[model samples]
Target: MKVRATAKRVAFGLCVFCLLVYLVFPFGWALVSSFKTNAELFATPARFWPAHPTLEHYRHVLANDDFLRAALNSVFVACSVTLVSLAIGALSAFALGRYRFRGRSLVLYVVLSMTLFPQIAVLGALFQLVNALGLYNRLPALTLTYLVFTLPFTVWVLTGFLEAVPIEIEEAAIMDGASPLQLFAKIMLPLAAPGMVTTGLLSFIAAWNELLFALSFMQTPDKRTVTYAILSFSATTSSAFEVPWGQMMAASVLVTTPLVVLALIFQRRIIAGLTAGAVKG
Candidate 1:
C-alpha cells in the first residue's frame, strides 16, 4: 500500500512537470529563435540554441515606422477601452450588487448573456455601426468595439466582488452622511480593488491581442494595432513571399513581455479576485 501511494505521487509530479514544460516550451523556443539569423534558422539538423545570437531582428522591428505606430495605437486603444469599460461596469455592478429593483436580475442576466455571444456573430453589425459613425480606420473604433466584450465581463466579475463586501460597511458610510455616489467612490471602490485590477488586466490583454476587429476596421497601415502589424511582417520581395520568422518571433516576445509582467505584478490580486466569496466561514 505504501509503495503504491509513493508511485502515484511520483506519477502526479511528473505529469505536472511535463505539463509546465509543454506550456512554456513554445514561448521559450520563440525567445531563443528570435536571436538567430535567417541562415542559422535554416541550418541543417536544426539548432535548439543560436550559434551567434544577434539583436538585429529586434532592431529591425523597432526601426520600422509602421510597427512603432501600431504599437502606439494598440496601447492607446487598449487603455481607452479598459478605462471606459471599468467606469461603466463599476457603476452598473454597484447598482446591481447593492440595490433591489424591478427586472434587476433580468438586466444582470442580459449583460451576462452578452458575453456569451460570439464576436463573429455581431461582426457585421458592428462594422456597419462604425461606418455610420465615420469611425472606421480609427483607434477609437477599436476601443468602442472592444467594449461589447470587455464591459460585460467586467460587470459580472465586479458584481461578485461588490456582493462580497459586508452590508454593514455601506450602512456605516450612509450613517456618516455619505451619499450613494460618495459611498461608491470613497468606500466600495477601494474595497473592490482586486477585482478591478484583475478585470482591467484581462481587458487590456484582450484588446491588445485582438486581430479580427483591428484588421476589419482599420485598413490603413498607420492605424493598425500590434497584432495586425505582426501579420504584415511577412516579407514580399520580387514576386516571392517570405515570412521573417526571426523578426516575427522577436515581435511576439516583445508583445508577450508586457502581459507577463502584468500577470506577475498582479498575480496575488488575480487569485484574490478569483476566489472572492468562494468559501464563507
Candidate 2:
C-alpha cells in the first residue's frame, strides 16, 4: 500500500508538471524570442535560446510613434469601457438580481442572447451605425462598440455576486430609511467589490485585445489600438520572411505581460467573484 501511494504521488506530480509546461511554453518562447536578434530568431536550427540577448526589438517598437499612440488609445478605450461597463452593469445587475419587475426574465435573456452573437455577425450593422453617428475612426467608437459585448458579461457575472449578498442586509438598510440610491451606493456596491474588480479587469482586457471592432471602427492611425500596432510591425514588409519576428514577439510580450500579471494578482478575487453567485447564503 505504501509503495502504491508513493507511485501515485509521483505520477500526479509528473502530470501536473507536463500540464504546466504545455501551458507556459508558448509564452516562454515568446519572451525568449523577444530578446533575440533577427538572425537568431530564425536560425537554421530554430534555437530555443538567443545566442546574444538584446533589447533592440523593445527599443525599436517603443520608438515607433504609431505603436506609442496606439498604446495610449488602447489604454484610454480600455479604461473607459471598464468604468462604463461597471457603472451600468452594476445598476442593471442589481435591478435584475434584487428587485421584482416586469419583463425581468425577458431582459436577462436578451442580454444573454446578445453575447451569443458572433462579432462578425454584427460587424456590418455596427459599421453603418458608427458611420451614421459620425463616430468612425474614433476612440469613442470602440468604447461604445465594446460595451455591446462587455456589458452583458459584466452584468451576468456581477448579478451572481450581488445575489450572493445576504438579503437581510438590504432589508436592514431599507428599514433604516435608506433610499434606493443610497442603499445601492453605500451598501450594495461595496459588498460586490470582488465581482466588480473581476468584471472590470476582464472588460479591460477584452477592450485592450479587441481586434475586429478596432479594425472596423478605427481607420485613423492616431485612434488605432495596440493590436493594430502589432499588425503594423508585421505589415511593414511585403515578404513573410522579411517580417519583423523579433519586434512582433517583443510587442506581443509587452502587450500580454501586463494583463497576465494583473490576472495573476487578482486570481483569487476572480475565482471568488465568478463563483459567488452560485449558491445563496
Could you say which candidate leads in TM-score? 1
> Clashing residue pairs in candidate 2, if any?
none
lDDT digits (tens) for residues 153-244 of candidate 1:
99999998898899899999999999999999999999999999989999999999999999899988889999999988884222356678
**Cα lDDT tens digits for candidate 2, 1-281:** 99999999999999999999999999999999999988888688888888899999999989989998999999999999999999999999999888878998888889889999999999999889899999998888899999999999999888778878888899999999999999889999999999998999999999999999988887777888999889877776558668898888999999999999999999999888888978765
TM-score of every candidate relative to the true structure: 0.96, 0.93
Error of 2 at 204 (Å): 0.4
Candidate no. 2 TM-score: 0.93
Residue pairs in clash, model 1: none
* Backbone clashes counted, model 2: 0
Task: List candidate 1 stretches off by more than 4 Å.
Answer: 235-239
